[model samples]
Target chain A: MMKGNTRGTEAADGKGSGPGRFLIRARADTNIQLGIICILIIILMTALQPRMFLSSYNFESMAFFMPELVLLSIAMMIAMLTGGIDLSIVGVANLAGIAAGTLFGFLAGEAGVGGLGTGAVILGVGVGLIVGVLAGLVNGLLISGLKITPILATLGTGQVFIGLCVVLTGGPAIVGFPSGWTWIGNGKIASIPVPFLLFVVLCVALALLLERTSFGLRLKLIGTNPKAAVFAGIRKGRMILWSYMLTGALAAMAGILLSARVNAAKSDYGSSYLLQAVLIAVLAGTNPAGGRGNVLGVALAVAALTLLATGLQMMRVSNHLIDFVWGAFLIAVIALNSLSARKGL
Target chain B: MRVLRNSNVVIALILVAAMVVIGLINPAFWQLSNIFSLLKANVVIGLMALGVLLIMISGGIDVSFTAFAIAAMYLVVRTMVAIDYDGVILPFIFATAIGGLLGLMNAGIIHKFHMIPLIVTLGTASLVRGLVLGGVGTSNVNIDEMPPSLIELGRANIVTLERANGTTFGLTAMILVYAALAILIHLVLTRTMIGRSVYAYGADPEAARRVGFKTGRTMIFVYCTAGALAGFAGLLHSSMSWLANPRGFVGLELDVIAAVVLGGCSIFGGRGSVIGTVLGVFILVMIQNSLILMGIDMTWQRVVVGGVLISAVAITALRDRRSPA
Candidate 1:
């Protein structure tokens, strides 16, 4: 592992509450703000539809839907930690799912439609994970290796990945993941959905990795101050490359959950999730410039947005309007963060 | 080697080389009719690209222009249908004005709050597109409902060509509009005070501010002009296609931006010529249109475009690193 200056490494100390501000200023601690926002959304939803918003069924459904989004958001957050973004996350997710689903269909053949044996599902997942890492490696190569800007490199690769998906599927959905694979996305244990449990375990593990591990520390320090990190003998390029690989792997996990839940994979599925993930990451207080964010904030944001979206849909709002609301919500948070920051200044 | 230092020459050389190679492989590429069609195809994208060029020169990026274009086109056509109005100029003006207004929103947020243009535009893209589809209406304006004069305006041609095989391809006069705007932008950037300020600001905002340039005004002008251009391009598109879909140009920002960059405009702001951008747009347009003519799979279009963009950007990035500012 690359080590930074022992003294200046405090910036990469992985503080849940830190001074890396994306907007005008982030003084009130993002977690608290996100917590408040989540509570407010819940209160509003409950007030608007008491029975529907509070039902166990609603929570379960949201649990099933929220994991993929949460996973993607956290993936986005970590990329942000390097002061770089992975716009290719959506493309990676879709591609990973396509690879995995294709594997499933190939293995299952004609007679094995009901469910695949455990081994095939595991192998398929491994394939997906490898594809995700490869995609990320390509991104890292373009951004870090070729010295291209992250946004442009990722943007280009995203198109390539999406086009590959299109060419692979020939413009149709790939269906029929075995029941065993689907169980990871749908089944429950002790009244808790499998997806939600996985989400919890994975996110908490990520938090620990980011907070306690030196690998994650090097990444944040790279984001906080590239020159300083370089002076501190950090392997910046290798670290960034590995970080994107990690990011891709996380996106793949999200893709797997999504494909399992929907019982299919396609190039065009979850097109809108890209914008929402960006929105949630920003809302989670993940500074766009990097070095400040945590899993807790992202989790709260995911919960809030999911509830907000579900409640709005329950009110019979158009999906486009919900998108508008989310956009407005993002801008509103940005403005408020800035305005309050100005006051602090 | 010295000439290669100028990216304009580099881009122009690439464009010519591509044309020669493609024309060699498929002689149909150099046909006058095909060339004119490519020109016509470039008009809308060219206009949008010019606006984006200006913003790039001012050190900002906008992804919301496509949304702006669609909104302006949809809202104007919807209003035209409702009022039973059928005229080219009015819709043109309305679209441009609506686009300008939305551009003002972007400019305001960015200049006032000092926010990044990408995020600001992303928000507006969602907000504006959603507003149009959700709040206004999602149903498209049918051709029959469209104003006849607008359609006629789009159909106007400066010259008509009849091929040996009996196919007719008239060069749309919209190319004239595009050319006039491109020339105007060139003149403004080279000859006007505001344009110089835009370049200056993009080169270094702090230094420009120190030099007493109206940094805020320049930013506003750049975004607003970009918006207006996008608006006009939108109406032109609908007129050309003879329909209005609120969801059209959904992901065109990538193509337009790629074209602008491919043209030699620096994404980091400043240091790009209008001619460079024009050549860049033509190269991209040629690449896109030639694929169909060359019988390549349409699905490969994205991959090819993306590949071209990456290589182009990589070349620029590596060269810049070698001789960085």
Candidate 2:
């Protein structure tokens, strides 16, 4: 508590001094620790399995693994910044992917507009956004109109969304994604992967949304103190709802990209992202209970996860064991976040 | 007058009506065979719900209940199989003990660090599941290789009844376990001083402390008991399915939670009943079974559960506003 207050005081003065420097250092320590661990893992892997870790093929493999989660982490980062969480992001993404795939293959194909052309692509993108917006609207209404807790509301939505994905896909994978679609997932712009570029654009846009705009400022305040925000004439309900909707849209976009990348949209495609996305948010120092965290923190955390996963694969860790590792990392970071939050660090 | 005033009683009546309607639509549903089948599938989830009720009543949530159970089951089966432990009871004891330890760890961490229960449990859940998967290697228990004693415990039945359709229906031993647990929990929550203390802590920790209740200790006990129940549930899951899949209970914790909430337990802690939660579990399971029987797409199952959960919470919130405590 004392440390927390001291940090608060320093921020108030718009300056740093005394233990404030140490506090800032400790906060930055989150990023440093992640970077160091990531580097250490990569180094260890390179030494232990130089043939695999140093190969360009492995680098390309890492690229394939990074996009969906990176996109999810960013979506979750948006909601985390506003002091809310979008647990339904993975489910929403999966559903959106299914929606895009089904439209391209079944509905559009039946309508004779499914030829590998611009029209089918536009239809797919439109379907993704629509599904995303609808999913977000459900979240918004449940939290605002129904007054359900975000956790419970999203848990239900997650179930519903996944179930819908299953029903739409008939519990099978939508194979034969258009070559154009795969290109988006496997493509590059200016020698940079499209997904990576998308990540950059999303981070910049979200960072601006959170740090620069008055709405963003209001949201942070609302997250910090909803009652105070309401007293300050901010529409707390509307803002919270907006945050959830925005998260849904981002999740949908991620889903569309995931479908393009995987070359097949499966019902359970986004299930794995559920743990990783939330872990990224918390690892970025975002509080699960709302209020406090940032885009840079989330981005770094995503990079760490991508690197870690890649390193694990290079080490020839079994996929099942890798899942175990993922779960452990999530728990470790969350526990640390909780401890830090409680101790006012 | 009290009966009319009791929300549980009202909800129970509604459940009965729903059940009767379902039975009317499908007479086979009322057959002893169908009832037993439903009971078999739901017993584990029901037990888990009881555990969750304790946590919720104590002003906390245990998202890790399913994960804890999964880990406990994995450890118990793996250790037993490896050591060639000869008794059915040993496996259960081993599983429940592991669960209890995990629960205690959760209670200890939450109380000591003053952390949010949800986040802590969320992390622990993942950690526990990871330990299981990593240690056991994603494999299913080959129950066919199990000793006769263990199989007997898993498949044993009592209370067989001859139906008009000339089919005999028998209740599995698992139902008896669930019933015994329900009775024990109901008694403990209502008849014991510790039980009252749990309610007090949940309703208002500050006030309970002012009245000399050891709120922290009570919380730890609640969590421990929750863990034990979850372990038992996990064992039941393995027993009924005859396989302990490493994937663990996916979304089962949420269903347990939904059951607890539907049982009229407040999410805000301090108020819940084992009986209410048990009834809630049956209601939820019945809804799921009924929907499947009606040929309603399984996808809509989640939508309904979500809708019901939201509605239940909304109703509770509204009731609280009308009669603030």
lDDT of 2 by residue, B147-170 (tens): 455666777888778878797777
* Segments in model 1 whose C-alpha atoms lie over 4 Å from true places: A1-28, A109-115, B165-167
What DockQ, between 0 and 1, does each candidate earn? Answer: 0.47, 0.42
Candidate 1: global Cα-lDDT? 0.84
Against the reference, the lDDT scores of all candidates come to 0.84, 0.75
- The candidate maximizing lDDT is 1
In the range B1-325, model 1's lDDT, one tens digit per residue, is 8998888999999998999989988998877888888998899999999999999878777889999999999999999889999777778888999999999999988766555566678888999999999999988888888899988998999988887889788989988899899999999999999999998887777778899998888988899999999999999999999999998997789899889889887756666789999999999989998997778888788888888778877876776667754
Reference-based TM-score of each model: 0.94, 0.91
Per-model chain B TM-scores are: 0.97, 0.94
Model 2 chain B: weakest 10-residue lDDT segment is B316-325
* Per-prediction CA RMSD (Å): 3.9, 4.2
Q: What share of the true interface contacts does each candidate keep?
A: 0.51, 0.33
The reply for model 2, stretches above 4 Å from the true place, is: A1-29, A32-41, A110-114, A334-345, B1-5, B162-167, B205-211
